[model samples]
Target: MDHRFEIFLACAPGLEAALASEAKGMGFGPLRPMAGGIAFDGTWRDVWRANLVLRGPARVLARIGGFPAVHLAQLDKRARRFAWGDVLRADQPVRVEATSLRSRIYHEGAIRGRIERAITEELGSPVADDGVRLLVRIEENLVSFSIDTSGGPLHRRGFKQAVGKAPMRETLAALFLRECGYRGTEPVLDPMCGSGTFVIEAAEIACGLAPGRARKFDFERLSGFDPQAWAQMKADAAPHPCDLRFYGSDRDAGAVRMATANAERAGVDHLARFECRSATAIERPDGPAGLVMINPPYGERIGKPGPLYGLHRDVGAALMERFRGWRVGVITTEAGLARATGLPFLPAGRPVAHGSLRVRLYQTGPL
Candidate 1:
């Protein structure tokens, strides 16, 4: 049954426009950008396609219902009215998380308690902490419940078993790559390649690999979901080849090792080379110039931005000196630090929330 499903796409703030554009390109109809996410109407299969293809969205949520309720009794009654058994198994565990925005349920803990109580009392199932089989999101007095079709956030592509400090998220990495217009036709480089997210994402894109092919999803546990159909979908979507190669380098040996391990696990080790080298020692790949994207460290937590200024300066100078005719994109938290790069960055784009800090993207081409 191709039932009506609401898909919520979580994204970095200020990137909703870009994410919406990408959804349009992918033939998703009429994307409406909301606070913290975007909503689109589609079927369960569309959710599968989204998790497989969308690079900008952090997580694609299927919003099942948004019924309004003013009190706990009403909420429980409404929750019990829905067809939870159709999606959740009786023996498995599930988790429900709720948030209140201008609603009577002010305390999140209290709201969680009510939902848990209702589910267990009405549905006769105990919640499991570790082996959580389902995830539901209740928002703004509207209980927009959903099952996590993609297991453990799509960014945990299962390939990155190892990583460096301050490594960029794979989802954000792919989004930045798209923003930089990286089609993977030309060689791509990440000079300060902590855990090699950028280069690895580029390699996967170039080779036409499905990012979610290696992992399992929560939808696989649902009652109506077809395992054979999912397997067939994955089998139909295998990797293909392209001309461009991916490369990354880092000054820290530990980071290079992690990058190597991550690339190897992703099954694209043959298409990438990770080396231990500083930004100053960077050189163009064997082929023609392509995109150069960097996510440099910002010492915001230590409350010191001086050293980062010099690092950005050094990166900018090295790019100017060696990477002529190359397109460059840099993501950083501090505005002054990005200016220190001294590249002809067009007016800065809106800052997007990255974990705890807000980061902005700056792009420029070598003159």
Candidate 2:
């Protein structure tokens, strides 16, 4: 058998284009950008590589099989005949989740129960609510089945035990770096580095380190897994020596400690430096100009927005006065706060759904 499968790279709603660009640069083939993700055709090896290398996708899913089922009876019958043994193992417990849209089989709970029973009865596997997830989507009378190849969200990265109040996810930080035209050749600075996400990600990218190197994936437990191939793939990761250094700073002492420990855990502590300093106190280091990215508190869940205006203004002043040739990327939830900075910002991107509030990335040319 060819063992080729259709794969979906899930990302934040507004970041599909950035993820597609990164995927294409990494050599994933036959790709199409969708509403919330990117779709592509690849084999098992490709699946493993994607989970190992992709930095922007929240998760990687493999479309296993599908069929047209208008009602419960047809769904049960078709699901029973599907090749369950091809992907799932009899010893591993599984979880089935279903969503219906514009289909006669509209009850999500009933659809999940039928698929769960079918897999258990046919494949002799146990069903658990928290086990590996198998997603079923019914749309316009067509049912599609996919397996969550990535166990947890890729942002976990198996590092950073401690986090700040509104820490940015590693995947989003990587995409933001790319959006700011960062190609891993120059240094990066994060004035409000919550848990050091941006700084660590920049160091990893510059060193050519794989994001999933320290983590495990759900695909390792599948029946089609090849240990020898996986070992070879992991061994092929080539980490290069980087001359550029990354920096992060925060006023909270505990946050600075967390960032330092996280950088140490990520094995990039030598290249990344963290400090406890207010944003306005940040000074440009002695080097060529690079990118300065910050995800400051947007007052959505924290303090009031009035005081943040001055904070943003002070940050803008520090950047404009000290770092004259560097570009800036600011992620905030309000346009007024960005405008308060008084920095000459270019046009903002679409609002991205981050938690309950929508956020946007405002960029600036060299100051």
Each prediction's TM-score against the native? 0.91, 0.98
**lDDT of each residue in 35-113, candidate 2, tens digit only:** 9899999988888999998899999999998999999999999999999999999999999999999999999999999
Clashes of 2: 0
For 16-107, candidate 1 gives per-residue lDDT tens digits of 77777778877886778898778889988888888877767777777665578777778777777777776666666677666677776567
TM-score, structure 2 vs. true = 0.98
Stretch of 10 with least lDDT, candidate 1: 130-139
In angstroms, how far off is 359's CA in candidate 2?
0.4
Q: lDDT of model 1 at residue 24?
A: 84
